[model samples]
Target: MAGTSDPLTPRAKLAVTAGKAVAAASRAAGRGSGSVIGGRVALKLDPDLLARLAQNLDVTLVSATNGKTTTTRLIAEALKAAGPVVSNALGANMPAGITSALAGGSESKFGVIEVDEKYLAGVARDTDPKCIALLNLSRDQLDRAAETRMLAENWREGLAGTKAVIVANCDDPLVVWAASSSPNVIWVAAGQMWKDDAWSCPSCGGVMQRPGDDWFCGECGFRRPTPSWVLSGDHVLDPHGSAWPIHLQLPGRANKANAASSAAVAAVFGVPPQVALERMYQVQAVAGRYDVVQFQERDLRLLLAKNPAGWLETFSLIDPPPTPVILSVNARGADGTDTSWLWDVDYTRLTGHPIFVLGDRKLDLAVRLEVANQHFQVCDSLDQAVQMCPPGRIEVIANYTAFQDLRRRVGN
Candidate 1:
């Protein structure tokens, strides 16, 4: 069992020990990360294991449709600069995975946790975090995770009276509405590129009016809150109107927005913006996303775009025109069961790049690209897809499971 200042109950100690054994066995067997499965067994023995493990730690919960893992990693890095920090850095956001991580890092002074949007309320209740960062919400894995508005309302209802300071994205109307219930909130103008989900106000189900960058509901009075932290082009301005130059090893504007959010959350832990951003610069990738893998005589830079909003951001991160791009999609359990979300993205953005599509849902993606008047070659595997392109450096963008599949294949 992990060493903690607060002594664990006899059952809790036994549970933690059993869980560690299972996780070690799992890793040795080449099964998986083993965090979730280990935590599950621990929780079965002691249902309150997560809460017990997190009780003595200063925890920060990060929830979003996208960028949760990366933001969590950034906050952890900033917090690590201050002192010891713990995090589930392997893209696991559920209670089970979180518990396993907490148990492993029992003596860490701070904890940065990534939580799924649907499970934010429950995890927050158990962790009693110092703060909760709410990133933008969009339609993702809709089959299992309810609609965006419904998830927002869940956040609203579940977090009505809690004391966790909410660090929320003001540009996202849904996030604004959800965080509205919490009085102690630091609104951040982290830009939202996907507006389809926010055009309808979550407040009164009325039309939302967006005149330029500002947004307000026409029918209801709910409007965008004034932000204390803003992410302007290549810069982040703090509340005092001082600009912090955003220079990150991670590519793309979306990651810059993530950095801005992380700086805000780190401030609660007494970390200054300059210090936070300076430490965050050390993070080059989250999990395997944005990491380059050498495969079949080509350098394939991996990018994970799990939804329409994610795809929009991914298009900006890849190499320029004439560079070959490989796109993959899967409707596995981790990904949503429905492939209908493929139609939401505008595939025409890849018009100039030599595009190759593969995965379990390659046919579905092919049909969507056809409808968008985009040219794409449908192949059966990553190797086949790369062979279709004459590539020295190729780009590969995949959704949840598909990204993991290729990450494993290349041993990256």
Candidate 2:
């Protein structure tokens, strides 16, 4: 027999190296490992790290274009409602970030992780989660993801063989179609989540129909059952206003969808609906993604607008502009390196006079806003933008790269 070498010995070295590398690069980049920003060095590690880490724990992986971070955090909290658990709740949804998170809590029994769409297959194959949540597919990170259709196809291919208890959002047609093809699937829907951005039929190119509050393939008449756990009006005590004594502590229609999905998935694992709702209500915002901050006497709400889907959702929350919005756009290689994705975002909905556009690429943001015939004041620096804005109610839309810049400059 070969001499016994400690199996954990090699992993210990890898873990130390991974942690040091993540910490060093993040420090150099003026960010932290668990923050909404992705670490520069975490992507350098092999994708198998998360899979290796998952071998030691019972894990649940959540993936989607939007509502992922919230859903991931919600599920983790829901599970925690039943008992103690560990999670990678920093909004770092890729394989490496999940690795870093799991490595940080190597001793925990349940590891709930949020994963990006692109890395779903790789992480799923490696980690083999006990449960998985596939939220809706939407136009997100167009430059990086190319398109939502491509993401849907990738997800279908990736999740074909996974033995996870799949919790899927059935409201989105694409998600419903994908989940229908999968075995052992549970559906979660957001009834009347948003009617304005209704998707057209993929096959016939006709307007998709919503009959009896349930979406269907308009052309083909491929009617699917309404989700078992639809968000009823009664379930949502407050859709827009915050803190109305609902099941979930968070507000926003989008947050309701996220909470619904998390509740559905938790219920699949024997967590009672009442218990899940109670735990979800205890959940709060994760850092700057939707974190409300009081800085320089201004009540600022920070939201991540990495792609069109996120921007659209954020748009629905705040009142029509002239609210002195702070729009930040930055160009870095890691943050898609190209600002072309900005065009995909619907800039028409946002109408404001002299909006404060700041960051490394403030001029680009200004130009984009100007083309839309919206008033935007270009700032030489983020500090100037902060100085220009008054306290009490400011909305800041920061892209992936812009968020890092904002944190350093605005103390948000």
Candidate 3:
């Protein structure tokens, strides 16, 4: 509010006040997480609360089927060097969550929001963001998000009229197709590790060719766009062909790609490359992602993999066999009631490793692992599972609900 000169309408002001009151009461009563109910009340009072609050703010929106949270955290961390920055860092990435974050950070002129893939179009249109980062498109929440191609088409239609500069991942064909029509686009080859969801060309419905890291559609002649910014091994290359070293505490090549995307986005906002990389290195974790917690004398490194594509990336980051790992799965509402996605993951990667299956869907995972000829033991108690592992650091890979439960047990 302090950064903007635009005055809020009386009705909008009343809506904001009522929303804040409801949020306060909800927190005091301990009935909800206090993230969405406040925004819900505000929207109920004034249906256009989001567009009003978003006015006169420079916003960068990050949306993807995966890595949106961590990538958003990286971008927000880097952009803070410019000035005061506000973000929805809690991983509540919907209309309600976005409204709550905007209301909470009313004094900041810059906003970095992580939006859900399904709701990206509406949020982007409402916020009129300065830049939109499109990470990748993959199968996620099949019950809710209809199809990957359909989502991309929706994004293409939603962003057709926006004037914001689009920063897109060129390595992903679906992403390329979605942002191709944008008048101002900056392509970054952030590297797409999971290709199971994009085996077919989004343009001509032809079989896509993946020769090494590059991809092309032979029938339609649609290929991976030549990127302006490329993420090579341990380095990010600029348009001038100069490379800068990237060092991040977050593990795996996926995080390196996230850093590259953040650096590209930061550059568009006038933040230097070196300065962005330096700021990103200081980020230890993002919303409990890749965070180490001590549980029962064992230091457990938590990794959240909600779907097959996420599992594929997480598996590639894990250390080779002989390392003790815990695999937890759940079929809760937040975890997507359908547990069929578990079968889509390649569990043979952990064949030789000692795996302890936990969570409500442990039996389901155990059966799948058995079919894949992977040896694993079932543990009813997480404490017992930890005790079974050797001393020192242990890896814990969990889905949505299981990961949240573990985070709660670890007390942050």
Candidate 4:
């Protein structure tokens, strides 16, 4: 509505109309990616549609290697208490997707956007977000994103011009380095479980010392920033040292860290921590990250893990040994072509559990499991995999394309 009011010229309005028509046609034709197409059309016509639409709006941009979608949803849900909120709920996180979301919700004055890691700086600069949440950074989409350190440097440079309040994860050294230059930063020690990607100091390139949960560089004396918000046990510790219990429908400690970061962002907008936590508890599933779908006689709990770091975190959320699990891996564009990251995952933890592997890269996963000495059966289809599992709940953990395939097959 910011751009739709009187600020937009007649030509801009016409471009918006044409883009909307194309999006509508795309949806009717059964192509689910209408948003990106629409945004592309609008941008091609005007070129500055995103910046125009973002003017004068209160924006919060959420970015991370993982958990961007779910964390953005949680932040959007909490922000809804203040008023109507706009967000990219469908997980189209690039410039075009973000432009489409803003164009669709033109009337809303507040927005929470999930930004792709590579596009974080550009999106933040264009949107001029009031609060920018910097979640943990790790090795992701190596084919396109190059190196994690380079991505952090891009973020550091991109955010140097913004006046936005920065809420960052102190547990991740990369996040700390990226946000260190921000004039106004609120550090949160939202637990970091995976350390394989961050063994060395990002600042001095020295060996990082991790005495406990806190990390520091022994060479240049670059240490983890003292956090104002921290996830301790089952509660989130506020700046005042008061603890607030976290009760979420979403599983894993990763989600808890996400909730803590969301709460911190909400607090920047004057949203009470209690209200934020209460609203977070109501989030049953984010896109298809934690959805349970019934396939034939079996109920499958879906968990999406795109890389080694993600797999490590997701594996901890399992119900433990004796619980039957299905693992799906794909080498499609969305899942990244390199299936070598599978070997980096600690599959030995899954040894005692009954594992069923299925996907385009099922054989690749099968080999990895066999090398790890984990007992697993390879199924050609989801139905066969579901039937192979013991009666009751079956946990299905998959990469990008495989996860989407499962969601579509089960009608989730």
**Model 3, CA-based lDDT:** 0.89
Q: Write the per-residue lDDT of candidate 1 for residues 59-141, one digit (tens) a residue.
A: 89999998999999999998887789999999778998988888898778888999988899999998888899999999999
- Candidate 2 residue-wise lDDT, 1-412, digit = tens: 1122332446554654666665766668866553322322333444345555567676788887777778888888888865556777867776656766766665566788888888887888878788888877766544566566666767777788567888877677666655565677876656444333346654345677777667666578755555556665436222232222236656567887787777777776678666777877776667557767777777777877776667777777775656778888877765665776566667777775347888787777777787788767888776677678866678888887788667656665
The per-model lDDT (C-alpha) reads 0.90, 0.69, 0.89, 0.88
Which regions of candidate 4 deviate over 4 angstroms? 1-5
For candidate 1, list the clashing residue pairs, or say none.
none
Candidate 4 local Cα displacement, residue 326, angstroms = 0.8
- Tell me the TM-score of model 2: 0.82
Q: Where in model 3 is the C-alpha error above 4 Å?
A: 1-3
Give lDDT tens digits, candidate 3, residues 1-412: 2346764688888888888888889889975567688888888888888888888678999999889999999999899999878898988899987888887776776799999988999999888899999999988777777699998998998898678989999999999999987889999999887888899999989999999988999998999988999999999998888898999999999999999999999998999889999999989988888988888888899999999989999999887878889999998888888888878899998878899999998999999999999888999978889989998888899998899888887887
Candidate 3: which pairs clash? 1-106
Prediction 2 global C-alpha lDDT: 0.69
Whole-model lDDT for model 4 versus the true structure? Answer: 0.88
Task: Assess every candidate by TM-score.
Answer: 0.98, 0.82, 0.97, 0.97
Summed backbone clashes in each candidate are: 0, 1, 1, 2
